[model samples]
Target chain A: MVKINGKEHEAAGKTIAQLVLDGGYKPERVAVELNLDIVPKAKYNDTVVKDGDSVEIVGFVGGG
Target chain B: MIPSKEEMFAALAERHGTDMQKKLSEASVAVCGLGGLGSNISIALARAGVGRLHIIDFDKVDISNLNRQQYFPDQLGIPKTEALEQTLSRIAPYCHITADTVKLTPDNIPSMLKDEKFICEAFDKADQKAMLVNTVLETYPDKYIVAGSGMAGTFSANLIHTRRVAGRFYLCGDEVNGVAEGEGLFASRVLVCAAHQAHMIIRLISGETEC
Candidate 1:
């Protein structure tokens, strides 16, 4: 199981884009981190999550 | 008669204790983006006697900004940095303010925020917010960044809060609502988030680092 946003999940071997989609956040409005490193938006579809990886997906909302 | 600078400092010391007041007076903070969040945050920091404030913004005040931003109708068309500086000086007569009317980009952030230990991210765009946070985190590992996010709509004022995201990076907002959801920004709700950011910065300066 891989950890996403501090919770364990069966998301190993999946792309960051899938994780973001499964989490119900817009692709353009959020940023993803795979194993403590920022995953650029362009690489979301290419970067794959492995077991024991800690992922943090933070969403951004408009407004000051 | 208006009190002298020394008298104002004495009054603040009496209220906050001399040591804490001194700490505040010696601290320098950079408030990026003079919008609703930045405007309110700057005023709170200045009133607390924070020694210096570096305010940056390239936009001018418009009629639409009057609803949530701290600007007057007569000040419309004036650059936000200038308008906010004029307002802050009246509240804290002795507070030193450096206002810049320029758009901040990745290349300029380093020099703009080099001397500030506390950085406030108050931009209105999600991409800009992320850019500032990422740049500062990567460029200045030791600096503390207090950012605002998701402060829109008519939700409960108590829903707004400050949370420590990662080491030395704190975020203030509901974390759920977004203006994209069709909920417009309200002054009351926006001000609540701004207060959270301001209070968090003050806590950091006072050695109370825990969020």
Candidate 2:
């Protein structure tokens, strides 16, 4: 199982791309940092999620 | 002898009162760009009691800036930071100030932001804003940089909105909406965005909010 926003979820062999889609966010607008390393947008599809992996997704907002 | 927190607060209160003296004595901030947004933002921070301020601006004051910039007409042709330093010193006599009359590029941003708890991005160009943001994030991931955009022309005060874009990176003013090229800005909207930027910086510094 993986935790997202502090909620436990069944991993079930999901890829990073599917997890982002399941989280209800546009992948392009958000950056994914997994285990202290940034995962480029181009690799979202190839990257797979594993148990105990910490993923942080940040989105852009208007700022000066 | 070391003073207790209460004693220190009381001493500050005697000079600037509890509200302002307390806040100004606790903050260290940097303002990049001394143009329309930077000019007003620096003044507000000084008046609000930010303890230390670092101003960076390469441009010089011109006759045109008198309409919006707080600098006097006599300051024409002087570096923007120099002009702003004079004004800020008078407003916050006890505050420490460092003025840099140079552009904020990737090469020098690291040193410019050294020891600064908060940074205000008040540049006029989008590329400059992006450069500063990228460099700061790459170098100091935890440092907060509050940026402004789309404050180009005369717009209603309500149009300005301050939104958090990322951890320690906040965007203020209209985002997708902006004034067209060649348009002139009014004092009302410029000051509105400037106030929001200053307020956000204060909130971040005081730990009232996380950027």
Candidate 3:
């Protein structure tokens, strides 16, 4: 099991895409970085998140 | 110590030590817009011993500005730049202050910001803010500007965030919550945003934080 945003989740070898979909957020609207490196958009489907991994997601909001 | 700029420097040297006092004497900053956030930022900068300050604002103080602008009632009709210049002189008499009562536009942004190391984008309108940012990005890539947005109405203090989006440019205030056109302003949100801007300015000036 792993924690996503502080909530415990069962790790089933979930890809980044699947995790984003489960979290109800649009992947295009947010940028994800694992271990301080940005994960390219094209690699979202291929990249996998292991247990106890930390990910930071920053979303774009409209601002002047 | 005798009572003068030299004497003040001597007194500050005794308090903060000579090296810190010398750094304070070498700092120079420019603040745009003399309204709410700008007013608070200018006061804080002056108090913090920033050696030189350039304040620019074209708007005149109005009755509505009394609530949160930090100007006295008698200064209602004076231009904001002039009012701030007078206020800062009384607050930090030894610091050098320059006031420009002119509006900033694309045509004059370069010359206006040439001498300023740090600029506070305190403009009230979104168009002006965008213009300043775009102009700085295009013309003067080296200059740093701290900008603010969504500082209106009653919102919790937790909503404000100070973030750096690029080199030498930090955006403060509530980006998610925007103030609608013609909406009335509140003191709490304005002060909160102003404090964030001032804090970032101090951090950048003191070398405690980098863009």
Separate clash counts for every candidate: 0, 8, 0
Task: Give one digit per residue, the lDDT tens place, for model 1 in B63-89.
Answer: 999999999999999999989988998
The candidates, ranked best first by lDDT, are 1, 3, 2
Give the Cα lDDT of each candidate.
Answer: 0.89, 0.74, 0.75
lDDT of 3 at A32: 51
State the number of backbone clashes in model 3: 0
List residue ranges in candidate 2 displaced over 4 A: A1-64, B1-20, B177-180
Which numbered prediction scores highest in DockQ against the true structure? Answer: 1
lDDT by residue (B54-165, candidate 2, tens digit) is 9989989999777677889889998998889988877776678999888777788888798887899887766566667656766786788888876656656788888765
Candidate 2 pairs with clashing backbones: A62-B171, A63-B171, A63-B172, A64-B147, A64-B148, A64-B171, A64-B172, B24-B49
Per-residue lDDT of model 1, residues A1-64, tens digit only = 9999999999999999999999997776675666655676668899999999999887878889
Q: If you score just chain A, what TM-score does every candidate get?
A: 0.94, 0.78, 0.74
- Docking level of model 1: medium
Query: Each prediction's DockQ?
Result: 0.53, 0.11, 0.07
Q: How accurate is candidate 3 locally (lDDT)?
A: 0.75
Q: Highest TM-score among the candidates is held by which one? A: 1
Question: All candidates' TM-scores?
Answer: 0.90, 0.72, 0.73
Task: Say what the interface RMSD of candidate 1 is.
Answer: 2.2
Q: Model 1 shows how many backbone clashes?
A: 0
